[model samples]
Target: MTDPVHIVCPHCEAVNRLARERLNDTPVCGKCAKELFVGAPIDVNTARFNKHIERNDIPVLVDFWAEWCGPCKMMAPAYLQAARRLEPRVRLLKVDTEHLQDLAARYNIRSIPTLALFRNGREVARQPGAMDVNGIVSWVDALMRHA
Candidate 1:
């Protein structure tokens, strides 16, 4: 990697600049000393969601879901699996639409399980519905290739 990338901490939302090669070293935040990428979906509200989308140099994959949505619950494990497979390159997140209705409205998220990929503070691709791990991986991979 030529230049360090900005990574927003999942635990504290503090920004950290790290070399791309160090992403696999279980890097910790400079400010909070918390592990940067934990290989799981971090549930976020509007503030945390804005920090991640606005700060991260890497692509961010967001799962916009609600608590009472049965399909969202069904796809939780698959989203986790996708996180494990996609992290160090992608930042995976979950936003409860019910809790952050403003964010849902801002993104125009009409469905419970919508996957939106953001790069450099702009949405690049979006998919609405529940998906298995393979489906998530392939969809992201295809979008990344074109990005």
Candidate 2:
């Protein structure tokens, strides 16, 4: 028998083991009973941010932004829309640069509204500045195809 893939629930932060074959299907958290793969950006602090990036099997797209940036504010809605469209297949995360300065520095993010793509805990690509929904989707799709 194959080992089940474990997924961390964004809602309750519970880890649940799901059959690998059922990954494409809807997965619910055993503890919180919430859908494990929702197409919405999950807010992450410094600690949880590291955990999610390291543990998740799916490709993760993290938006590094600060509240004070105008472009960042303008891009928030577009980011959310992309998240809603790419649920289950891709995981979306947001990191506040103000709260997680260490993380931002580690990634060498010189600008706000930077997007980073990670697979298996390794950063594969990144882009600075805000992107529209279609642009974000295309970039993510290309990243997956390359991976």
Candidate 3:
């Protein structure tokens, strides 16, 4: 078995300790008993976003977006497709800038469709703009390799 990793529950926002080997086995949360990785971009408010970014051992890809932004809406489907390919390797998150402006300002998100990659509670790389599924996948893959 590998080391235990801290994985914040996507359902209840409770942090769970999980073995690295079992991350792909459809593990359920210890507190809420809900599936941990649901294979989609989780819509996170401030509290959940903080917990996720700080607690998760795996890398987190956050799409900082707003409902009123055209590029953000245009990239929504691509983000979802990227989500399917990313997890349970990465945690894909959608943060609405309009709802959580503090998070937006904290992350220095000047653009609507900014994609920030975080690991161990620190940002590694950020890309601004809308990218298709393949482009997103390739960008993440390159970053992951370098990281």
lDDT on C-alpha atoms for all candidate structures = 0.95, 0.88, 0.93
RMSD of each: 0.9, 1.7, 0.9
Ranking under lDDT, best-scoring first?
1, 3, 2
Q: Tell me each candidate's TM-score.
A: 0.97, 0.92, 0.96
Instruction: Tell me the tens digit of each residue's lDDT in model 2 across 1-147.
Output: 457776778988776887777877788889989889877899998878887888887788999999999999999999999998877677899999999999999999999899999888899999998899999999999889888
Of 2 and 3, which scores higher on TM-score? 3
- Give the winner by TM-score: 1 or 3: 1
Candidate 1 lDDT over residue span 5-60, tens digit each:
99999988889998988988999999999899898999997889999999999999
lDDT tens digits by residue: candidate 3, 1-147: 789998888988888888899988999999889999988999998988988999999999999999999999999999999988988889999999999999998888998899999999999999999999999999999999998
The stretch of ten residues in a row with the least summed lDDT in candidate 2 is: 1-10
lDDT for 12 (candidate 1):
82
lDDT-best of 2 and 3: 3
- Most lDDT-accurate candidate: 1
